[model samples]
Target: MKVTLRTDVLTNNNKAADFNRELFESTKTLVVNIMSSPGAGKTTLLEETVRALAKKYRIAVIEGDLATERDADRIRAMGARAVQINTHGGCHLDARMIAATLGELDLDEIDLLFIENVGNLVCPSGYDLGQHHKVAVLSVPEGNDKIPKYPQMFMRTELVLLNKIDLLPYLDFSVEEARKDLSEINPESTLFPLSARTQEGLHEWFSWIEGAYVRCVRQ
Candidate 1:
């Protein structure tokens, strides 16, 4: 019974995701779903991402957390339209939650939409939120073993942002080991080691986004 119920839930979620994809495609908006463990700098990365690209593109964000509208507020402070989805006790953001917020956002007026999923390595991996891309954030502080350990998350995401590289010198985290592990798990995926605070190696991420946007909207 439990298995059937869970499958049913996922089926319904997929339906909602299809709806969201159609809407996003119709509006020519590029939507990215960002996932990571709590404190992996998903919000800070987004904050900086918005800061860098806002002038060139019409950016919007959908911040998902178990509680608090803080992330959404932070994005709004940066002069972009943001919607906060409080999932209460839910571990991840579902398609229905995103579908509900679509009405609140003017999709035609937006060029990019970043959905910051509730920070969890496990729960967020299983849900489809109707995004054009799914990128995972893995911080240096989280250590090198995470990529191989959390295979589900790494397996599903095409890109991995290795945040907090600034702390690499002080900590025992290794970039080479991470690369090796990620290669073993998902060789097709690219890992960008960057620090949201110092903005190191961020331009590559921005360029990737530029390419993604062009592919999504123009091509």
Candidate 2:
């Protein structure tokens, strides 16, 4: 019975995900679902991303958190459209929650839509929000062992943004070890080490987004 309940929940979520995927594809909007453990700089990274890409793309963000509207507010201050989804004790934002928020934004007018999943390394990974890509953020402070410790999150995501690289010298983190572990777990996945604060290696991330956007539209 427990297994049955879990299956039913995901099955329903997948249906909603399909609905979202169709809507996103029809509008040619590039949707990226970014997930990470709390304080992995997901919001900071997004703030920087919006500031950098706003002129080139019509960017918007859907900020998911367990309670506060702080992250959404931060994105809006960057001059991008943002909507906050308070999960209210929910560890992850499911597909239906996203489908419900679509009406709040004019998807056709937006070229890039980023869904910042509720800060978590585990629960957010199992659910699909119909995003074109799923990227994970692992900070330098979080240490190198996280990739292997939380293999599910690393295994499922196509790209891993190694955030807070500015602290690399001060911290004991090893970027090489991270790349090695990720390769072992998910060879197809790419690890991008960057600092949202200093903008180091961030252009590579921006370039990747531009490429993703081009592919999203061409399809």
Candidate 3:
């Protein structure tokens, strides 16, 4: 019965995901779902992205959290449209949650939509929120073992943002080993190292978003 219930849930979620994908495609909105463990710097990275790219793109964010409108507030302060989804005790954001929130924003006016998934390396990776891309954030304090320890999260994502690299000198995290492990689990995935605090190596991240936007519109 447990298995049956789980299957039904996923089946329903997939239907909603299809519905969302159609809506996004019709509006030409490039949605990127960002996932990470708590304190992986997902929000900070997003704050920087908005600060730098808001002028060039019609950006909006869907912030998911177990509780709190704090993240959404931060994004809005950065001069972009943002809506917060509080899941109460839920561990992850599903397609239906996102689908339900879509009416709050004008998708046709948004060129790039970022869904910041509830911070969990495990559950967030399992649910499909109908995003064009899935990105994982791994901070320097989390160490290199995270890539191997949380295989599912790294395996499912196309890009891994290695945040907090500014602390590398103080910490013992190995960037090379992280790249190697991620390659083993996801051969096609790329690891991008950057510090959201200092904005080092952020241009590449912005460039990637620009490229994704171009590709999304052409399709």
Each model's backbone clash number: 0, 0, 0
Question: lDDT of each prediction vs. the true structure?
Answer: 0.95, 0.96, 0.94
Better of 1 and 2 by TM-score: 2
Order of quality (lDDT): 2, 1, 3
Please report the TM-score between candidate 1 and the true structure.
Answer: 0.96
Candidate 3 per-residue C-alpha lDDT over 1-219 given as tens digits, one digit per residue, 9 for 90 to 100: 344444565888989998999999999999999999999999999999999998899999999998999999999999999999999999999999999999999999999999999999999898888899999999999888888899998889999999999999999999999999999999999989999999999998999999999999999
Model 2 C-alpha lDDT per residue in residues 148-206, reported as the tens digit of each score = 99999999999999999999889899999999999999999998999999999999999
**Candidate 2 TM-score, true structure as reference:** 0.96
Structural similarity to truth (TM-score) of each candidate: 0.96, 0.96, 0.96
Runs with alpha carbons beyond 4 Å of true place in candidate 3: 1-9
Per-model root-mean-square deviation over C-alphas? 2.4, 2.2, 2.2
Worst 10 residues of 1 by lDDT: 1-10
The count of backbone overlaps in candidate 1 is 0
